[model samples]
Target: MKRHSIQTYRRIIQITVAITFIILPLLNQLGFTFIWGNFLNIHIGDLTLSDPLAVLQVTLKNQYFSPRLLMSAGIILIIAMCFGTIFCSWICPFGLLSELVHGLAKRVLPNTFKKLNFQISGFKIKIYILSLGLIFFFLFCTRPIINQLSMPLWYSQIFQYLFIQKHISFAVLFVAVILFAEFISRNRLWCRYICPQSFLLVIAKLLNPFHLKVGYRKEKCIGNKNNNPCQKACSLSLDPRTLNNLLETECNNCGDCIVACKKLGKALNFQFSRHFS
Candidate 1:
């Protein structure tokens, strides 16, 4: 196998492990719980890695906030900055669905794929404000109102409102819009714009070791700059050649760029740090 294909295999394993950690409990197969089999859990070898979903629940519950939770949140945020949306790319169920939508969109609308920027600046501006509110609500309110009330979290109403399919809240409605938008756009808009989790991850990932990078051979990358299909093919639609270009943290490193480079036969390919191996 080629060097890059080997790296891809490693990444797949990493993601599978992470997703399994989150998925097992929902099946009642993990065999432990926080309170009398109510809150399902497991111990990782000896030390519990903490149920990722439970950890998320604790983060959203004002009652569960602690120095430990804060510390964990910090750690998660740091990781996100480096890998950006590793959770979405690798683990999230909804994210997997979004990826399917993206594949279908690419097939159905090849020219429109990644051509339109669904990223609204006003929406970007609100993420900071929303993040601040979550922090404040976690610290001061009766519930971590903003966090629990997050649009993505609302989907759990699928189980939360299991028996009685009642009316949806504003947050749920917002989540529905995001889901609908996934069908309408190339990449899922919710993952790109509104997810506070990705926001935290972006922070963590930025300071960590490395990012999905192209071995940029400028001599080769320059071709049809005015109508660069490589940039147009990017879900984030970012120009890869500009001097200060790594600003787009929404990249899931799905290898679309790799395929684009190959499509145009551009002299570019992914490079990973030795640590990732």
Candidate 2:
């Protein structure tokens, strides 16, 4: 399928998941017992799908482990290994909002909203944040505290609360604050840097050298400085022209660059291969 079609599929998946979470809690409150719990700990029928980072934190510090949690996390990791952190693009509810916020900022205030390109990579900073979070969890027993930082989880929790308790949560404020910060930064600051939950999925994706990823054919590219649509289309500010191992780890394979290049040079397209091999 074309890159645009693939992106449309992703958006449909994202929106469906977001709406499902909102409805599940409401159904449960209305005497339906099929699904329960928020994004941190989801229970659908007899199966459970909990956040891996949250499970890891509790397991390490409290010495708690459940077969259901491991199974759920393992399933997610396996998917990530094959698809390269697609959860960030096609599943995570907050990603939709973040993308929208960034897109709006760029259109409304193009010059002022242009992000400050940092010399440092987001992966390095994300690793540091993950390490610090684990350390704090192990030392201070601050396990649930880290959950507050999860924007997607917060989105789910907000709906869960609104449905279960029939009230709004202050977590909506946290979502608002993060969206505002991302709007100002004009980048995916949280997903790229601060979101510890994504770190494990990224690591899982790195394990599979051959996976679905955006492939750049530099020779095919009709290099043009003024009409660099691929770069502009990239939400994470990654240069899709450089097809390498590093790009595999950083990119969520959203296919925006590929779509951007479609009418231009057709230089970028989705390919499954071991580029290093």
Candidate 3:
């Protein structure tokens, strides 16, 4: 990942962003809207996206949630927990946007955002709210429905907004979800702090070897050499110089370390390895 070519991964992300957010909407503008998402009963990966528990917990109108859908959700969850969030960087729009935001935040915030603290209790607030809210609402409200003020479905329903055309209420969730995760948390407060979709990714990152890790050559990391590139490169405020715990789980595999190491001559490098290690 160091001293190589342009990251085709980011290119793939840019292309997907265009096709999904741009092309799909443009197609809908021409009255090209179809129930393509519904014409099928179920597909293999559809479950992962539909996320039965996700849809069930929310106010969204379900178009698909077959048994296969449930199975895919389960399997992907198992995989993500063991493999870190390949989905976060590769598949999730929020994740990709967050990565972009990480770069932008560094440039813009300079002092404020970089110095922010990611306290454990601060991180736990999302899940605490989600769990307690789900129980309280289910018990009181007659509809045993799911609450989704912050889910991926909320976002997809956003893109589907330009297409749905008629009842655009679902778009409200889209807007609110985006405004909170995108504008507010900076990057991945939902995924890192609130998302159940993140449940497995957190486990996976905790156990996966391929997670973004800091290779700190202990002696050199101390600043008599007067160098601190790894600390500077971290977008997550995770200083590679101080990182001994791989179980931080919040590590998104963006190569801030690789970027940081260019000045340090490979003192800090990130490579694929077992999180179980």
Candidate 4:
């Protein structure tokens, strides 16, 4: 029997989550109230799961803390601490869509267009955006305004609006526009640079140095230093061989590079250690 790659399992989980959200709203409409709410705040019976950034924004805006909300968000943060933002690669519907769009763009666009150099670090830009948005919201907004920028929330809410309200949300067009822009640029601009929601996950992952991450063993590597298949396999254009500090923060443990390296030299792998080698 042929063993499936990590990406195959990741895609299964991603597709399952995407389909589950679409069906959840329909089930709620049909009078099943066991599971409710969108990705920003979801409840399954007595348990709740929420976006940590949304929870933080609400706590800041209201000057109050809800233990329930904190606990819900903590669950997600703990997962990030252990697995390094696997939420983006394994479960987010918008992520799955973005990856698909990026794949299509790479196939259709010219090679020259795909090689544009981005001098600014994407993670730093995300932190800057997160900081500026929080500062602006803290001074000027009354509500959890940052929640408005969550693509995963919007993705889930689209199904909620359609199934429960029988209304089409403009968010469909919003997400489509972002995907279209990414396709044209041959880049995952939103996931890579713009999404503020992921910053919390990145921070959580950073807090724990022993969290699961890609480890590259240079001795095991047999590929060229500059032009390796593992590097080419990265959708985010990251070189697995050099995932240190800021560069590591951008990796979601998607395992594409590991899979790409498996046949060649098996140099890359998932490990729970501080050292990359």
Candidate 5:
């Protein structure tokens, strides 16, 4: 029997997370208090998990430390340090939606619009946006303003508002609009450029030199240099062959490229090393 690809497993996990969140809110409404809260801060029995960026905003605004919140956020950051941004690839509901939308765009959109180039780096744009958001929050906001930018949080809260409060949130429209724009542009714009939530995860991943990343072996590669299947397989439009260079920071270790290369030359694989080489 043929083995399932990495993307198949990733899609399974992503769908499970998405469906689980939808169910969690319903369970909470029915007095199933074992797992509670949205993606910004969630509790599974005694264990807590939180978005690091949300925790940072709250910590900065309150000017006081909550050990529980700190530990919760630290756990996420530690995972990012060890495994890169797997949350983005494997668990985020928004990510799953974006990937599906992107895939549809690729299939239906014109070839001319498939590869649009941006003048500035997507990661740099994210950093700039993050800086401005923090500045704005520090200057005038009383609440954790950055938390509003989290798509995952909004995704979870959509179910929370529907099941618990019986309220229809406009956040569903907000997410739809973003997905529509991405489909039109044939780019995963929110994930690649606009997400402030991923900035902290990227930073955490950078801090750990030996974090999990796609390792490339040029010698093992037998495919056409001009037209590589690995590059075509990447949903983020990243080149797996050049992952050792500056482009490494943008990679979320989704392993789509590795799966694509498996039959061609088996040139790409996941590894934990100080450098991709």
Candidate 6:
């Protein structure tokens, strides 16, 4: 398949999943009670799928575990282990919003200013935040304070409240502020720097060395040595050329870089193997 075709398919899936969250909540308001709850906790008939991290927090605090919660969390963790947090690329509503705003910023901003690099890496910051949150949870019996920073959960909750409860949440304001910052800064500040939710998934993916990932063919790259198109196309500012390590922890396998490389060198492709180099 053409590289753009692969990316277009991913975009369609991303848009569909984002819309599903919005429509499902409205369905409940219209008396169709087939599904309910936000991303933190979702129920469909007898089956449930929930945030594994949220489940972990509750289990730790109460010193109790429900079969249903464990099952739901297991399903999500299994998916992450196999596909390396594909949820961030293909299912997150907030990721869609961030990508849209970032794309527009890319077009308007000069090339030299488009990619911003903070001295502190976003991935390390998220790990630090996750460590502290878990420490607080154990010491203070905190009520999953990390959940409060979840933009996608907030995105889904906004719709659930608006449709199911006839109420508006202040969480919408948080999303708006984050999006505005992303637009001006031309960086996915929230997803890269502060989202503690994806931290667990990243660890799971790292443990699974054979997870699907974007691969790079260094021999075929014909682009200018100084300027890499694949790197430029990355929404999260990841260097796709570094296939040896593949930056598995932070990359969501979004395929934007693959599409960008296809036109110039056809060096990047998605593969389902542990051999990255």
Off by over 4 Å in 2: 1-4, 63-65, 110-113, 142-144, 244-246
lDDT of 2 by residue, 1-277 (tens): 6344666887889899888888887788789887877778777788888787777776777676777668887888889889888888988999888988888888886685558666466788888877787677777775656676787788988987787777899998888998898888887788777887788889988888787788878777886777789988989888887655447667998888888888788888877787722
Segments of candidate 4 deviating more than 4 angstroms: 112-114
Residues 96-126, candidate 6: write the lDDT tens digits. Answer: 9999999999889787774666745677888
Instruction: For residues 1-277, write the lDDT of model 3, one tens digit per residue.
Output: 5554224665487457535643455555675554123201113232323443453443323434556556645565555645445555556665655556656655676465433356563235645765776686666654323435434445455555556554465656554555445444454455556655554456545665555554555554434335666655554556555554432555555555655665555555555464322
For candidate 5, what is the lDDT? 0.88
| Candidate closer to the true structure by lDDT (higher is better), 1 or 4 | 4
Residue 255 lDDT (model 6): 85
| lDDT to native, each model | 0.51, 0.80, 0.51, 0.89, 0.88, 0.84
Per-residue lDDT tens digits for candidate 4, residues 34-134, read 98888888898999999999889889888899898899999999999999999999989999999999889878888777554474678999888888899
Give the alpha carbon lDDT tens digit for every residue of 1-277 in model 5.
Answer: 9989888999999999999999998888789999998888899999999889988988878988999899999999999999999999999999999999999998998887745646456788888889999999999998888778999999999998998889999999999999999898887889988998888998999999999999988899998867699988887878888754335667888999999899789989999998666
Better-scoring candidate (lDDT), 4 or 5 = 4
Winner by lDDT: 4
lDDT winner between 2 and 6, please give it: 6
Model 1 TM-score, 2 decimals: 0.62
RMSD of each: 6.3, 2.4, 5.9, 1.4, 1.4, 2.2
In model 5, the Cα lDDT at residue 196 comes to 87
Is 1 or 2 the stronger prediction by lDDT?
2
Using TM-score as the yardstick, the better of models 1 and 5 is 5
